[model samples]
Target: MKTFCKFLLFITLITLYQCKEEKKTTIIKKKKLDTETSSVPEKKIVKAWDSLNRHNTEAFLTEFGKQNPETKVLIKTDFGNIKLRLYKDTPIHRANFIFLTKIKYFNTTVFYRVAKNFVIQGGNSDEMYTQKERNKYGNYLLKPEFRKNRRHKYGALAAAREWKRNPNKLSSPFEFYMVQKKSGAYHLDNEHTVFGEVISGFRTLEKISKVRVGVDEWPVDDVKMTIEILD
Candidate 1:
């Protein structure tokens, strides 16, 4: 009877130990699973402005234009707000402008280059944020979209290019100039990509053009600008 009782106790201990081991294994697995789930990063939504590579050609621009048919953008500045209507005919340039605006790429930029009585060039500044934003958007250029109808008239919004190295006259993705002179800059009609024109706030353009500038054409006082896509 004593031997049987001992045997029964040993068996119960063995069973209890096995059960405890199984429960511990289950807890470890659950912890590992919870940790793995918590560690997974959320998937980020890719924006059109993200990964703007040179490979994105006319087709991509066309698709983008198709998606966003509305052509207006509001340029907010300390001076005032200017409204611009992008030309559908210049699809590539228009699409590029729209993409930049949608991404808030022009925020905190400045009307850096102001040609007195001629043009007010913007979309750049000496600020660190400006450079950081530019670096975020890859270096890419748009082939000049010079339609016969798109002239560099007063309030004409056109892209600027590096004329020295850019023999092809591809426009700088980040810089644009607005014609502020009463007598239009007709000579630049076919030379630059005039994507949009100011529909309202011509006075603001004029005011920016008249701002005092130093030797390099940079405004003596910074005229910060923020752009938003209206439609």
Candidate 2:
């Protein structure tokens, strides 16, 4: 009977020890699971597109002017370089252009549309990177900033928009064009926002304007361009 009792006690002790080991193993597994979970990287969140109507125009314009006062930019193209000066009267347009240039948004974009004796449109391309950049920036449109004093004279820098779809004549945030005609495009005065004018590189503008374009008005040979803020 004592042997029987001793054997029973031994069994009880072994059972206790096994239970303790199982508990320890469970704790180790839980700790390992927690460590693995902590090692996983979190995903980055990007801001959604804020429409133009939602923006506080007064505050936006004020902050933009205060931050980006310089009104000059140099457009470097595969053909040649074109220097431009933004108009102070069109503060919003000027600030927006400068902001895009500072961010290198024009890099790898092609002078997609070239109309001889009319205009040379740019600031967009068919490349995936161009679309990616645009997506990264978010979707938004700029309100028209037309001034009587600002006309589409030769080398005039103006924003392009969808006239058919946009009844208000809202300017596109990404696309811009340069007037290449010797005479000003007077018809575009109220239609588009003339933000800046070319101070130099008329020859360069001429060269880009003469590039061959297909049916869609896209340049046959890609005329890529990069922009730099001069002032």
Candidate 3:
């Protein structure tokens, strides 16, 4: 009986030791799993579009055009509202202008450059908000969509560009001008991309073009413009 009792105590001790080891091993495994889970990197969130660079600009604008298919817009200014219709031929420029309009970028800008009786340039301003607005959007230029039929007719709307060193004549996406001359500024036909034309705003264009301007062509009084999409 004494031998049996001793054997039973030994067995009990062994069993206890095994149970303790198993508990420690389980705790270690749980800790290891928790550490691994914490160390895993988080997934990145994707956006529909980002800053408009040369590489992604065309595709983004093309897609944006499909999504936001609007063409007619009204430009309200101190002079009067100019009703304009964007041409379908200049798809890229049309989409780009629509995108800018929808974003309310032109609301903070003005007719910064007005060449009396020749052209009234807008989409810029001297105010700090103008620069901030530009900074908020991506910096990019539109590839010129100079259609063979498009010309700088009276009240014609066209994109502005940096003439110096721009061989391709890539248009500045923000700045644009209207040919106020009745005879038409035919000289600028091929040089600038005529993306749209004044539907019925020649009188307003005439008034804006004749605003009193400084030596730099900027109006003495601010010519603020608020744009709204009609369709």
| Clashing residue pairs for model 3 | none
- Tens digits of per-residue lDDT, candidate 1, 1-95, equal 99999999999999999999999999999999998878667798877646576677566677887897879999998789999999999898998
Arranged by lDDT, best first: 3, 1, 2
In candidate 3, which residue ranges exceed 4 Å CA deviation?
A: 1-43, 46-50
Candidate 3 minimal-lDDT segment of 10 residues: 46-55
TM-score of each: 0.77, 0.74, 0.80
- lDDT of the candidates, in the order given: 0.86, 0.83, 0.88
Q: Order the numbered candidates by TM-score, best leading.
A: 3, 1, 2
Worst 10 residues of 1 by lDDT: 48-57
Report the number of the highest-TM-score candidate: 3
Tens-place lDDT digits, model 2, residues 58-92? 45555767777998889887788999999999888
Model 1 lDDT, residue 212, Cα: 85
**Segments of candidate 1 deviating more than 4 angstroms:** 1-48
After superposition, candidate 2 runs with Cα above 4 Å error: 1-58
After TM-score superposition, what is the CA distance of residue 61 in candidate 2 from its true location, in Å? 5.1
41 in model 3: Cα distance from truth in Å?
5.5
